[model samples]
Target chain A: MKNKRIYQVAEFMARVLTNGSKNLVTRETGKVMREALEGRIQSEPQGTVVVLDFSNVGIIDFSCAEEVIAKMMARLIQREYGDKYILLTSLTPNQEENIHAALQTKRLLALSLKGAKKPKYLGVLNPYLMDTLQLILERKSITARELADLTQVEINTASTKLLNLHKARLVLRERMSLAEGGGRQYVYKSLLEI
Target chain B: MKAPLSLHEGSFEYLLSQWGQRLSYPSDIVKINLRDTKFIDPFGMVGLIQFGRYLRLNGRNPFLLLPNSLDVLRYLDRMDFFKYVQNLFYLEPQDFTIEEKYLRRHHSDVLLEITSIENTDDVHIIVEKVRERAENILNIHLHYGPMEIDSFVVALSEICQNIPEHSKDMGFVGIQKYFYGKKLKKNVVKIAVMDLGIGIKESLSPKYASYASHWSDLTAIHLALFKGCSRYDDPGRGQGLTNVRKWVQKWNGKMVIRSGTAYTGLIPTWEFAPYKRSSLTFFPGTLVSLILPEKSL
Candidate 1:
């Protein structure tokens, strides 16, 4: 474990509405968000779970959402952020949609505070595959045979499901050598809590 | 009506294909002749609406020439093109009124009624409503992805926001969606944003004040449209139109920007140049017309 940190998004924006309906709208608003969090993002050690909080943010349009969340995630992708994790907390459905589409466009992934259910995987994912992803997240490691026995599905069905998740880049796959066997067994795990 | 303003697009043809040619025609009390216009696409409608708006701004009264075709008439009505024209020209819904069939989505095209954008929040609301209107036809009706919708939102907001920020006055923004081809496969989306305040030429003139005597509308606009050019004195300020230009290229969209006496267009290539001469009739404002076409799903 490196370090867990939290950052507020609205703090960086010029809060105009004294009421609860504050948001960012300008074309440059997203650049501001990314710039404000730059120092912290660079200083955070590897495997750090940096929570970008949007609790008070009432609304965020798609452009700003892309510049702030999608662009940020792309920059901090596991290969780029050096195993660092960026999780969004307190995201509204509308915000999630913008962020999801943005991330999906760039083929990036991030977790949310709600563990696995709240649009953690970009925009939307198949309901049928939710449990499989959750099982992988919780167990920290999984195999097709294990998922087949646990979910009461055929081996082929489990393998197909796992392969789909792998294709989405939501899970990491590794082939382990069997000491007394000629074949290797592939293991899968969640990118979450990395 | 003896003369209906013909849209002159597709099957129906007429007035002027080249915009410069239309300058030679009479401009007093502009009335559309749509009788021969068998089909009018979104681009055609936007062209007609923008022409009427320019004429009206220049003290010309405009009216609609309703086509005898009921479907075409209802389409004109639903597009809300009637709202901007003279109320006396409003045609009654006679035999053309068909019972609402099939979950019809694209209703009357919307006009934002000369909005006075005061702040970024106001900018957001106007663009939000515009996006909703576009979605009614673009996504919910035709199913374009969120990426396209989001781009429209950002581009429209940036342009409209300029009215309040740089122009310091009110501006108008409007959009309409229709099909282009005879088979109704080519989805066309048109958006127009105009402001009656100081034009870009006058605003950016100070940047080129050194050549005060030699300064022309063409030179001023070119400076502003340049990648890093800005009207403001600040160095970090000039990506508004740059971003818009990039979006147009990405979507293969076409845009024509008219400010002061000179106008320029942006396309995928730079093979063509904008009209370098001043117009015989001066438009004291800036008008931008954008056309975006989507593949038939």
Candidate 2:
């Protein structure tokens, strides 16, 4: 049985929280954590705890996590807010590592969503799809169809994934003419130098 | 003018801090007295945005206090801060009108005021002549170091190329280098290049039109200096103005650019600001003035 109380420190803040029925938290729960920190900053004018009940969430996108948490944290710090604590009920080792890496690159001060439970140092892993997409962008102009063909995925799935990458500003899209007819086709290029 | 705000951070951080500090005031306020201000950076713009947002958050009231310069405010506006700070009254400097009139009256001594040059090939002739005149008056090797010469060539080429490429046949290049003798520290070299062609108005309009006015000359010049901005339709390497800005700052130089009625001043040490309008009229072109240090390499 998992202990009800888990306290841990990731980057800067110290997080403490009680486990709930769900194993992972919802997106709304994450937003509430951010709001809770802001409220704490307003009320206590000192340390704040951002609580995340991840008892319900099954998977989380690392980029989405950074956009919601790390970016907001940086903005709060810019406003002169002090250290913040994040408490999560559950986070997979891979998810934790990915979140930590993104936070470090953004130069944000963040604590693990998990509290005191020693986070297992799951071996370092590579996000191969992200890496592959970045590499293809550098050498040649790639389209969603081309990427799908290379990855052996459906065109719609590849297109949707590419759109998500574009939203993160990791790739740029340009309109080009397709051969069959004079219609505009979107070409994707990676912003990263892979 | 208000008391100066201080912060110990890079240009970006300092700007954010100033904005936060400014927002610590009430809304429905028209004028802010920035009296004791000393330093400014690209980030200094955040303060202006905060002030604007404060007004909006309160109501539709405008802030009417005069800033140190219209040029500075204009630059901020071009950087997209104007959208945040909707209402700003760029206070004209006290002596602005007088100075403009004075320069206009003495315009005869201003040897070259070529407003619209129709040819790109002629740019080389104009550059050589101006170089000769500056060297003759200062008695200093105007083209001493390789970097200096290279920068000069690049600056002139960039501006000249814009004439034929963007301005079509409606732009101008003006040159005026004044010498006060070699003995005095105040002896100066001034080169003003003016282009009346399309202006920055037509150039940057395609990208930022939704947020900016087509006639905002200040915004045009600001975008020109912004990193990776180009008026060209293609994804160009847009290094022209960025390089110009870097070179001028490296040498602790001064540059002023005026488009339409809006103008911005760039002093070596301090942040740039807007200057009040003068009666002096040169064709509707961009005017750039560079005052290189006497011993600058």
In model 2 chain B, the worst 10-residue window by lDDT is B7-16
Tens-place lDDT per residue, model 1, A71-107, is 6766664345565556788876656755665565455
Cα lDDT tens digits for candidate 2, A60-173: 323324434555645654544443333344665434543454355454433343454432322122253454444454454578888788889899888877765544433456
lDDT of 2 by residue, B152-196 (tens): 544554555555555543344443343435433444444545454
Per-chain TM-score of chain A in candidate 2 equals 0.36
Per-model B-chain TM-score: 0.66, 0.50
Residue-level lDDT of model 1, residues B84-133, one tens digit each, is 44433433332335456722344454434334455656776776566556
Which 10 consecutive positions of candidate 2 chain A have the poorest summed lDDT? A16-25
Off by over 4 Å in 2: A1-194, B1-116, B128-143, B174-176, B179-186, B211-215, B269-283
Please tell me which predicted candidate would have the highest TM-score against the true structure: 1
